[model samples]
Target: MQYSQLGRTGATVSRLVLGTMNFGPHTAEDDAFAIMDRALEQGVTFFDTANVYGGKEHRGWTEEIVGRWLARSGRREEIVLATKVFGEMGPGRNDRGLSALNIRRAVDASLRRLQTDHIDLYQMHHVDRSAPWDEIWQAMEVLVAQGKISYVGSSNFAGWHIAQASEAARARHGLGLVSEQSLYNLLSRHVELEVLPAAEHYGLGVIPWSPLAGGKLGGRSEKGVRRQNANTRFDSEGLNDQLGKWEEFCSERDLTPGQAALAWLLHRPGVLGPIIGPRTMEQLDSAIDAVDISLSDEDLAALDEIFPGPGGPAPEAYAW
Candidate 1:
């Protein structure tokens, strides 16, 4: 696996990060543990997870599972751990958001679950319009001083929001966001017009989620049609039963859909890493292998013809 600096921080992460969104819901605990082991064995040093993914019954045990994997494997130092906050956790009104009170309470809870004193990268999962920038930055800087988190990042934020937060941090708290994470895939190119350029301009490492447009770019297709009936989750948002428009690009180039899709984003400027969460080990292997598939200028030009711009026509599915 290739490694690169996680934004301006000294820490380095694998170009392809092992995402644990499906760990508790889609994958059993044993299987999740095995996935982590296999990924680490394959030189995947970066792991991404969120607090709410394990189901409330486990009380954040998804993070606990990763903690156990580190303990059992004795390879904590070998990996760069990344996780997120700011998702609804319980009935309480304060259970979510970027407010200082919640950020403090959440980090303590995360640390206890992860069995670690310091988090390598702590991320805000969503923007909290309720909290002022000063409040959020103050909490984050406190965590840094307390050794609870090393660096901070933002996810699912727009370019303007990122700029506002950065300006607040630098002008007031003297602590700034080091990276930005957003959805970026062959089917979803919305981030290219603003978010990508903003990250490059501000030196924020860009971590792309759903690099394959969920599984749309990786699934089987024939005659430019994809069988969306295979997964219930795939059947929603007017995207059901449609093959992604990028299929035409892949067919012309004789490349696998997933390869063409991933290769395209890998070439996008300022992308520090791509998050890949596969249900099965075989699927994971295919995602990892995409790094080796190179797309030439002609290939890119042809692909562009299928989905030409930031406001291009929608793809077969929007999940990825």
Candidate 2:
């Protein structure tokens, strides 16, 4: 597996993040453990999960599954474990958001479920509009002081939100957001419009979720078509034509659609890695193999022609 520093930090991580979102709800614990085992053995040391994973009825179930895996394997020191906050774990108003109260409660709860003493990366699952930056930072400072969380991260944040959060942390002489997780892939280039640029400016690594565009880029045309139509992106005749071209291009390069898609992200700016949530072992292997499939200039140019970005970054992408 390829390795790079996490953003501007000195800590290094794999280019492929092993996302555990499907652990409890979709994958049995045994299968999840096997996947995590293989990921670590393969040198993919970054694992990302969330507090609200495992669906609504069994919140935190995913983390519990991971906790068991970590205990069984005794490999906590080998992986960079990441989990999120800001999702409602219960009905109480204090159960959600990034307020100082929830942040304090959530980290402790997550630590217990994770069966770990410290979280390598504690991410805010979303931008909680109700929580002021001062309050959030104060809580994070306490966690850092207490050694409960080594670093802080953010997910699903707008470019402006990263700016606001980072600036707030800077004023306090904090490390700020070491990473940002966003939906980014060959078919999803929205983050390139601003978020990627902002992350680069702030030295936050870009961890892309849904890196395969939910399997549309996985070479399974039948399944891809089925999912795309539901999402309204490939329902139109013109889009179907583009997807057909996409498959044809992958075939010509002797690459699986998934490998090509991941390779593209590996080449994108500010991207530390793409989070690959594999339900099966084969899928995990496919993503790991993608790290070595270098894309030439011509190959990238063709991909750009197939799945164009937002013209570049704004305001140059828009005003200029």
Candidate 3:
């Protein structure tokens, strides 16, 4: 596994970050533990999760499992742990958003649940449009000062919002966010509009989630016996969206759409890490295969011809 510095931060993380969104809901405890073990064995050191990922749970069981694994395996020091807050966690109105009180409460809860004294990278899951950047940044800055978190970051945040936070941090001389997590994939290149440029300009690392467009590029649905593979998240509703034009693109090139899609992301500049969720070893192998793929200029030209960007480096409001 190749490691890279996480943005301007000195911490080095693996290029492939293991995503724990599937841990408690879609994957069982034993399987999830095995996956983590294999991932660490293969040199993947980054693990990304959120407090609200498992159904409607306030604190997902995934973190608890991971905390236990860290204790049992005695490998906590070897990993770079990342988690997010700012999602709806319960019935109360205060259960969500980036309010200072909630930020304090959430990080404390996350630390307790993870069995850790500090979080390596604590991120706001989304930009709270109602809250000012100062409020959120101050809270995150407080966490860092209190030694509860090693670093701060934002996810699903736009360029303007990130800029505002950075400006706030600069004015206060506080630790600003060093990374931005957003959806980036061959099927969803929306981040190229503003987020990517902002990251580059601001010296922030871009750790993209959904690198495979939720398995649309996993190569499982390709024609022939591969289509029948059960290792994929191939439900009828999702499969409906996966068919037609996209399939035609894959067919014409004689490439599995999944491999082609991931290869495209790996080829992209300024991609710090990609969070890949694989349920089984075979699926994990397929995702790792992306590491070896090198797309040709001809391949990139064809992709550009298929899906054109919004053009040049300018901050545009994206749907993501």
Q: What's the TM-score of each model vs. the native? A: 0.88, 0.96, 0.87
List pairs with backbone clashes in candidate 2: none
**What is the Cα-based TM-score of model 3?**
0.87
RMSD in order of candidates? 4.8, 1.6, 4.4
Per-residue error for 186 in candidate 3, Å, reads 1.2
lDDT of 2 by residue, 131-153 (tens): 89999999999998999998999
Q: lDDT (CA) for every model shown?
A: 0.79, 0.90, 0.79
TM-score ranking, best first: 2, 1, 3
CA lDDT for candidate 1? 0.79
Q: Candidate 1, clashing residue pairs?
A: 213-320, 214-320
Candidate with best TM-score: 2
Write down the RMSD of candidate 2 (Cα, Å). 1.6
lDDT of 1 at 142: 93
